[model samples]
Target: MTDTPSKYLLNVDYGVGGVTTHFRSRPLGDDLHSETMVLNLGPAHPATHGTVRIVVELSGETILDADVEVGYLHRGFEKMCETVDYNQVMPYADRLNYVSPIINNVGWCLTVESLLGIE
Candidate 1:
């Protein structure tokens, strides 16, 4: 019934008494809206975003949100392990990370050990 710059966009009501709103978008100064930019980082190994990606939304120097998208980084690791005995699976789990062989292997062992409810 009343138009207040952002009158209805408030909890009072949608345009009932609050102002308009965008799910995103910030104020640049006093009267201008901040521009939003999306930066995609990671999953850069083969140029495919289907594995894992970090999406960052930036407004000036402020970060609105940073999301980690895991599409298929370890899609079939479990399935791959399913076909082999636990002893043979260390190598497959090793495939998870080559940069830190010991840590990755230890993590895999810990994960499997925990799953089996053992120490």
Candidate 2:
């Protein structure tokens, strides 16, 4: 039996002839030793279905925390809109949701109409 310097003390058995050993940690800090891990899913991975990034924190195979990022597909969408006239911006809006572009087009129209106080 030996003690290792860690958050939890490890009990290890060194086999005879120094061939092999087995070890396990018994946490000294808390009654339940919950080790956490952080995972980055991606802005380019297929499962996400789009240019999005996810940050996940895990503890013992359970999710402890998560965060999401969107819009890696078109970073210039907003910037390009700013450089164009309102009517010209429709094309950019349509591209924002290419899968169902009519939704983006209608949403942009509603936003513009509301901003201009048009019925």
Candidate 3:
């Protein structure tokens, strides 16, 4: 065995290990006297228009930032569609958006008719 150590061991920087990770913990206030507050708008509350959750960072009623989270209406439409034929898919499409079943029914019928034409 040689007396020399590896060159890679001497090239490593020792100062990087001493550095501290810094992060801004809170929202910056609007002005010198104003305060910032975090408001969780909804997981089920109104004005969301649908099943959406939002966290709003506000400074005295004026919004600074907003984070929106969706997935509350987690119906597996795509997966359900895969297991059914075109003629059998209309009712499931209605369930995906019940308020617009007529539109869904019409679209489904049109697509099925088009596909049948090519066959």
Candidate 4:
């Protein structure tokens, strides 16, 4: 193995007659081994505007990790966009973010405009 810094090293000891082995002892705090709860917060609900699910892992009252899943609304954004005319995609973009939908619309418009070399 590559040389590791002394501070991070754990010494190993081999027992006589190939019977056993031992490693240096290090104490990990209780939280390291504690269980975490997974909480799922919606693809569609009053509190979160619908179309995204947030899964959060909690240790007691503290959040240990969070994962976000989007597009529960539909699966054909790309295919539908390909079939529609340029202007037709505007309305679809507006619905991307229900909370601040106009932002998504404007951002999509700007991107398309820039790509077409329209100033």
Candidate 5:
């Protein structure tokens, strides 16, 4: 008569000294689950001030991980920039970072001037 090992036991015959060890077939329970909470900050949250959506995983209100989704603001700027002259690209750049138009304007001007060897 032979004894059948439980499914969780690993049957290993080392030839000289055979041994069987029980192992967990499932992942260990997460201790983080008790310490953390998941939060969705914004698709339409007022503090975000825009259409940006962020999934934040927090450990007691401190952000542990964040996933940001920005597709709603996509204007195909890269595709548009590919079709335009250097001078024409500034306005689109202005639209992209509306809060700081002068910086975008100056940077675009400097870039165009550099390309033409004017500065």
Candidate 6:
């Protein structure tokens, strides 16, 4: 329905298509239709400490489509901060990013300090 074929075909904003609408493979042959396979990368063990699900569709060696779903790392950060005292939130923010957690902790502390009119 959109200007791009893949957007309407794959439902992923001009990416790739699937089964009945595999535009690329259709041009390869008419007698044999290429079967698409879906591969799940992860909902855990991500490079960044958070959990993420990566879905990839493949037609042989070529990638037909893909989708990425992001998770919250089960921290419930906002709610947790709300229930705790202002000083208690520093530790939680420090754990947000493993590679450079101190940055997050400092940023969170500064934000809370600003809100309380503390220089």
Best-matching candidate per lDDT:
2
Alpha-carbon lDDT, every model: 0.69, 0.74, 0.72, 0.73, 0.72, 0.73
Report the candidate with higher lDDT, 1 versus 6.
Answer: 6
Q: TM-score per candidate, in order?
A: 0.51, 0.56, 0.55, 0.55, 0.56, 0.58
For residues 1-119, write the lDDT of model 6, one tens digit per residue.
65645536555565543534222333446535647766777677555356777777888888878777776357789899999998999888988887899999889889888999999
Tens-digit per-residue lDDT, 3-22, candidate 2: 65344334244324655322
Cα lDDT tens digits for candidate 4, 47-80: 7776778877778899978887777677577887
After superposition, which runs of candidate 2 have C-alpha atoms over 4 Å from their true positions?
1-36, 72-74
Candidate 3 lDDT by residue in tens digits, 16-49? 4655422235545644465776687777896766
Give the clashing residue pairs of candidate 5, or none. Answer: none
Cα RMSD of predicted structure 5: 14.6
Q: Rank the candidates by TM-score, best first.
A: 6, 5, 2, 3, 4, 1
Q: Which candidate is the best by TM-score?
A: 6
Error of model 2, residue 21, in angstroms: 35
lDDT string, candidate 5, 21-88, tens digits: 22213344765357676677767787875578887777886998888888657779889999988778
Candidate 5, backbone clash total: 0
Better of 2 and 6 by TM-score: 6
Candidates 1 and 4: which is better by TM-score? 4
Model 3 pairs whose backbones collide? none
Per residue, candidate 1 scores C-alpha lDDT tens digits across 8-110 of 4455544443664223554657635537777767766466534667777888889988877676365488888889988788887676665666887888788
**How displaced is residue 74 in candidate 5, in Å?**
1.6
